[model samples]
Target: MSEQEHWDRETDLLVIGGGAAGMATALVAALEGLRPLLVEKTDQVGGTMSTSAGTVWIPGNRQSRDAGYGDTEAAAAAYMDALIGALDHTGIRAAYLRTGPQAIDYLRQRSEVRFVPSGKHPDYRDMPGAAVSGRALAPEMFDGRRLGRDFERIRPPIPEFLVLGGMMAGKDDIPRLINRFQSVGNFVYAGRLFLRYLTDRLRYSRGTRVVMGNALAARLFYSLRQQNVPVLFETTVQSLVRRGGAVAGAVLRTGDGQTLRVRATRGVVIATGGYGHNAGLRARFMPRPTPELSVACTSNTGDGIELGLAEGGTVAPDTQGPGAFWTPVSVTRRADGSRGVFPHLSLDRAKPGLIAVNSAGRRFVNEAHSYHDFVEGMYASHREVPTMPAHLICEAGFVRRYGLGHVYPGTTDLGPAERAGYLVTAPTLARLAERIQVPVEALQATVARYNDMARQGRDLDFGKGDTELNRFNGDPTQQPNPCLRPIEQGPFVALAVWPAEIATSTGLQTNADGQVLATDGTPIAGLYAAGNDMASIMMGTYPGPGTTLGPALTFGYRVAMHAAGRPVDAATGNGGQP
Candidate 1:
């Protein structure tokens, strides 16, 4: 058969991966009159996004203006300038800032993806341009029932994030659930959430009322279904099709053993979720003593980066932090033998009555730092102290009030976690230190010193509740320093945590328009990249909430626009040399 005869399918655009970026690309392509096909390696859509908080950081968004923040695009740019010291990606950074709000607006009008400004959600940093609430948009709860049978294709949220085994709950729900017994209104709200979940469980695998990243992904999936977009789940792109020295299409391998060749008239876009699960790439890119854990989907094994390299593409170098995005994670063995990697985001770490200590039982970081910065602290502390597997010390009251890592608040019974060796408990501080293999005397002194400072409403050592961001995430009900409280009650509990990546900063080099760039620092025609597959616009520095997803969706939209012969900015981005 001839070359054209071997083409099993043909399309205007071939998109790899079904994460937020890939899904948006296909959707926008269709809207722009380009026939696009999206192929996901897993049986479901939503890569890491489905398991995330799904907050999109788009400054100057309509919701922000309506909410009275009225942040300007210039102010956002100034914030980025103040936050990121390196100017390595100035061109793309400008593009992201310029187009991010537009992308959000585009999706709001054309797709089922709806977002509401999260009330009082502050930026991770209190930078000059950072607003207290308007910039961060939380996904609106999406009713999975809208997708019908295709609802099953939407990946469920992290098993641990669910309430009552199948019900989805937001960060707002947790505080209410914790205070449910204290208020009739809170009790009614909690009861209604449970009731809705129970009703949905009668017919669905999980509650159809999805929020966060699950809702965001589900909304995208529903929107695509509405447009009749062809989404090939359980399929992956094995290799890129090169024609006339440019990426034209790909060889797709289905979940079954079948291989099919697909040719694209416009080009191919790679958004394969980056190298989080790729052993070789992890070894090559991650820091020394490479962490063996990641919370991202297993299907994200650097397929896009590898494919891009075959066409002379280079992996963009990150000047700050590690190539991978950092998060302090606790490992838990599930009932099915698979282990759960739980990233300690805004929950337990920042709440009062908890202290994270190195192996020597000495306090290190503020603990209220952002998850990325928290892991960075772990690495820095580990250089002198064994900060790896640092233990978070708390008490019964602490867990009851705020919970630890995967442990839920108001959890009276710690039997399951204790029996599984996931949590260590002791009636006294010395005993708990002994149980966790930390110096007993050192641990006792640490707790005593901490209690003294906490009683004064101060973290003398690390200044835990100093930053606006820290106070925002801390327990608001607490007096004085919300992130500072004595951990004096027994039986004290301990949960071990280690640094792990939730995503990657390093990826295939791509221009502002999302076209994958060759080693010569020129755009390779018929090729584009987005999501974690594209080098981060932040240049490896995380500035605020939804840092990853905001740019992922923005650049994804830009890619689709460029693919459809409509570049968001007429000027091609500099796409800085590697």
Candidate 2:
């Protein structure tokens, strides 16, 4: 590799990683009248945020209040106290609680980012601090055409999440499009969306209208561009430049194998999207039998964490839970020979007429639980029996209505999926057990017990639909228990699911100001971390929809303010007392 000797660039602030946190850092710095340079290792921006649902769980945010929810800071604090319960990172938690709404307000007022509270989205656990709704906020849908030619620079969502090869849909769009056959209004709404998508395809390589995480990423990307913050794609930091024991800049390596020295006068922010794909780090930090599947950006291989560590930053110690965010994933090989891991996040698992059984063909968990909780069940089940590859068995009618994994609902052609061995089908329950390699009698008895409970509209075995969290992701239109329909219909389908990580909870330790801290509990000057690169504020607890993103945005804002020598008042948006 050819390396350049002289300084190739200079800026007030340098933000590494193009995901939400990095973008927020650069955006805030630019807004504060500093010249910011953002670098992304990938060919495009958006990192793992582009592939997510784009929701941020920010308690006491204005959007929630504006949406007529009575969520207060005290309520949020009480909830956190109940859930976190004497963790060491209370300072980070306090900072997040105080600054989260401020961050949202700043972004809404100054940037293109717009968030609307998911008024009905419940917290992940039904603990004392949990809210039934109004804490999670999602980015409003964005029109990709606004970006013009720059639209191509925004990383697209996962291929499996799209419809008709390109169009991105939101949570609400799914039911509308799927139920179009039942209602004329739904049919027209879906028709218009498809029409818009088809027209967009004629002009662009993919649909120009985007939603969810893609939209959130696009909004941030648009804001950065609008602020004239320069972002270098396919560029990464090789090493942090230190002067007087403080990070001064970085030695950057470009995609063409050329290296250049870049100086930052303010600070360098590390936002590389965690260590999800780094095998060595995973083996060290994760629980035994480390997950091989990750839904995070493939480029996220712990570059930022390693860089911070090399610069004398400390990693947070292990907590009560696994130091990684997890989800159950189903894999499919595309025609192009690339494997696609579809995360079972609120699509089919929580809905009625579904049951997840281990290799012994026994039900082990409440099927309607959150994805993180579902993986916990897998881990627990694995301790007893072989449950690494659990099967999500659903009836033919459920498959036709709700779809399993990557298989779409009302799919006329199962030829491609069947050829790829992604979908296992059997006309009888015994046959399904045989095909999936589970015991026949065990499977039959499990379904029989489940059917009796479903008929009574109650889950006596595991209380599947008992909690608000379970019902939140379920089909509300169902009679009696929303998440408890019987899976008695034949021509059954079963999709194999594996433990997969969505994000790493363990990361570089940082203080309340988002400054990277040393092992001796002192902040490393001019060094900061945000997004998944920073140890999670929740301390590995899956609080709600946007726990990762909420802290990411808040700390990104904090890092920029601290670097700019601005006062950070957590109580108000304008740096004032409440």
Candidate 3:
């Protein structure tokens, strides 16, 4: 049959969404000798991992397998259960834990993707059964220039957390950040970032080659090319075509509005991310007054989720479960009137002795908790009070010493929000509280209570004195009470904070191998989902470390292997890498 008269294109596998998961899936399929077509709607790839911190928390990972650390599946399972508590689902959790190591090992051996242990970044639980040091893995830095013009398409790391130019930081460097003389390593690291920027500018006419997010994505993109994977950017899967209740192929739409019907001989993998960007889905699942903020890629809009739902798949935690969303982040408007969001609270919670309170004049959680925990509490608080926003309170010392975490357009040279004062500032705690519309007396009393505790060298109200991560954000110059010092300096500030959905964890339900399943427990033949597009295997709970990317890549590989008919290695219990 003529090419145009017959099916538009035929491939063994069609992987949608070119993020970490989709890229990994296509790579595996290509390696398995299956011609794979990768569809990424965005101009570039690397979804959130490209523009954000590229850490993949894989418990009992092979990265630490040689360090003499014990990381059995049982141990990892226990750690997950402890961290997420009664909220986690055992079946899905077990699959994630058991398959994690093999997943890491497969990627390491087969692709340019490499990881190093995130030393000292503790599990959400300091609990037993957790690998003390091997639980987290971040992408080793890669040069973005390798992708050529594709490098320009990929999203670079946001600069708020990026001190010099690099957007990643060592786990131990969190606390040592504020200590000017003491943070010699951070200083040297900053110097290296600066050097990376200069080198990239001279060689590639781009300043982002050495950074974390773009670098990681660039590596995966390059590796996918080397493996001969067919990546089709600026293209989208319009709908999944079915034959006898099985996915047959997809109706694809190109940037030029050309429609092509491609046959998926094996399966169609949907890693198109969740519906965070879709207002209708967000309103349906999330509680009312859901702000239109998303830290995830703009490209994620439930395209895969919608297609799966239309194909009669069930989406679980569909209505509830921590709302299973990424937290609202602090952002400022740029000169172009675009907003830049930053997740770093290193100074606010750690060094500036800032106290976060809701609109109702109360502290809801330990301000020093992980970013995810903070968002969960924000969601809960918004539900409790009909109020639309929360406040981040910091004092003069915080702004003067640590810098009120600035958000810039593309880089620092572009317009920043710090100059705009979307970050509200005031002379007194009372004035700051009043300006932000919180009850003044209540705010003062809260600060006074914190000050009393700080002077006594303790934190009785909240366990701020607990972790090194907390102390890193504390005022070490204040003696005895590093994290306990209250926001006492003359000028205090409070920013209007809201919970921005980075990506919804709640999504289409899938089985152990990343195959979408009907409510009756039968697999949807020739259909698969991964990344934020797939239902979170951890249930509604966020596990410690690289919770997002871990399952994303793992399941991506699983779907490709299954599609390619690769044998499952019974000994390793890992399905063969495609």
User: Residue 433's C-alpha lDDT in candidate 3?
Assistant: 80
On lDDT, the candidate that comes out on top is: 2
Q: How far is candidate 2 from the true structure (C-alpha RMSD, Å)?
A: 2.6
Clashing pairs in 3: 57-546, 175-472, 328-499, 328-500, 350-473, 350-474, 351-473, 351-474
**lDDT of every predicted structure (CA atoms):** 0.87, 0.87, 0.70
Candidate 2 lDDT over residue span 1-578, tens digit each = 33333568889999999998999999988888889999999888888899999999898999889889868777787788887774544467877888899989988988899998788888877777678878999899999999998999999988888888899988889889988989999999999999999999877878887888899999999999999999888997889988888898999999899997998888899999999889999998888789989999998999999999999999965653587888999998875889999999988998989999999999999978888889989999999989989999988789788788898888756567777989888889999999999999999999999989998999988889889988877889887988989888788888899999888889898888789999898989889999999988777678788878888899998888888777485443464212
For each candidate, give its TM-score against the true structure: 0.96, 0.96, 0.89
Q: What is the lDDT ranking, best to worst?
A: 2, 1, 3
Estimate the overall C-alpha local distance difference test score of candidate 3.
0.70
Q: Please count the clashing residue pairs in each candidate, in the order shown.
A: 0, 1, 8
Could you give candidate 3's per-residue lDDT for residues 235-256 as a string of tens digits? Answer: 9888888877789889999988
- What is residue 167's positional error in candidate 3, in angstroms? 8.4
Of 2 and 3, the candidate ahead on TM-score is 2
| TM-score of candidate 1 against the unseen true structure | 0.96
